[model samples]
Target: MLNELFTLKGKRALITGSSRGIGRAIAMLYAEAGAHVIIHGSKPSAKLDEALAEARALGASAEAVSADIGDINAVKGLIQAVGDVDILVLNASMQHYQTVPDFDPETFALDVNANLRSCFLLLQGFLPGMQQRRFGRIISIGSVNQWRPGARLAIYASTKAAQFNLVLNCARAYAADGITANSISPGVIDTDRNAEALADPAIVEKLRSLVPARRFGSAMDCAGAALLLASPAGAYINGADIAIDGGMKL
Candidate 1:
């Protein structure tokens, strides 16, 4: 029964920005649990192709899509291409590391478009089908910055906070429809995105000291929570924000 609770057999999942990192980990795990997985990237790349191939190698039906989610037109095309899915993972985001005063309008707009607007657009496009099916799971990959706002992550953190609010709204409005919307806020993780920063021992030590866990998180750490939220195990959980931060928020 526990296995059954976690199983995603017959479910179709579309995970955005799945070429690598936490998104790829979730995609791979979903495929292993019997879901037909759709992995996406902003554009075609070897990483995207490799993720797709690896997912298929797990004996699950898998495919890849590419779109710059920051562009409304591209997001529309992505929606048309994906059609309908049981699970939608909003994992793609754009982060700009600039002080609030020094931030440029163009970069701010791009970040908002990709991080917040794209989530709204995707939810709007996919919710109808989910409502009709009476089953849907929406998981927005947020950041710990939502709580521990970084000095240079003003815009990124603001968008993530807004995104979680959107999740709460959807969860409240769609609970009766058998749809669940949640967010996962990950703390410092050892992914390619942090490779450069973490490469510096001083920076790594400083960040590590901040987390009670005293260690960096892995993509798989986030993936485990994502699986729980995506499968039957989390059927009754809604409007929840799970922090995969290892007590960093505290």
Candidate 2:
């Protein structure tokens, strides 16, 4: 049953912010593992549809839904569009790294809404169905900053911490119904958005020094842990915040 433990042969997963970055990678991987995936994002993007279609071509059912996750009305509309869900992956998040003198109120609020509040909204829509079915997996993508707060990102760090604790609370509240809640805190991942920061020789050196593994994480690193918790292999795992940071906090 080893393969069965990791197989998502007939599952349905809803992944938010899947147009690019880590979200996109996770969506594609989950589909490859045999789950019907619903690609979600803010506003409709042809590219997102393309990703969904590609997954369908790979022998998995997939679709795309566009919704501004931070907007309650929009999120409600999107939820009504897709009725019930078996798996939920809250991977949409916003970040603003600005020093005190330059930080803007609007930007900070946007980060809070996207990173923390949006998670609440999504769960509000899907949790009930999961409870009724007595089977569900909810995984939220958090940040390493929650455990290792960084400079110029206090607000982002706060939201990540919120995700971590919320998972525990949600798990405890829903476990008896056979639903599981978990979070993945990823370290500095090598993505298009982070290339510039990591390209700086000094910053690169610093990052390497900070992580015991002396390397940056790839989308695959976080995706691997996510799949584990969202699959049968993690049936007994709940109320957990898994860290995939290559020992950066030590």
Candidate 2 weakest lDDT stretch, 10 residues: 94-103
Q: Say which candidate scores most in TM-score.
A: 1
| lDDT of model 1 at position 174 | 96
> lDDT by residue for model 2 over 99-148, one digit each (tens)?
55666888878888888888888899899999889999999998889999
Maximum-lDDT candidate = 1
Q: Could you give candidate 1's per-residue lDDT for residues 1-250 as a string of tens digits?
A: 9889999999999999999999999999999999999999999999999999999999999999999999999999999999999999999999988889988899999999999999999999999999999999999999999989998899999999999999999999998999999999999999998899899999899899999999999999999999999998899999999999889998
In candidate 2, the residue pairs with backbone N, CA or C atoms under 3 Å apart (3 or more residues apart, or in different chains) clash, namely none
> Model 2, 69: alpha-carbon shift in Å?
1.7
Q: For each candidate, what TM-score against the reference?
A: 0.99, 0.94
Clashes of 1: 0
Question: lDDT score of model 1?
Answer: 0.96
Whole-model lDDT per candidate: 0.96, 0.86
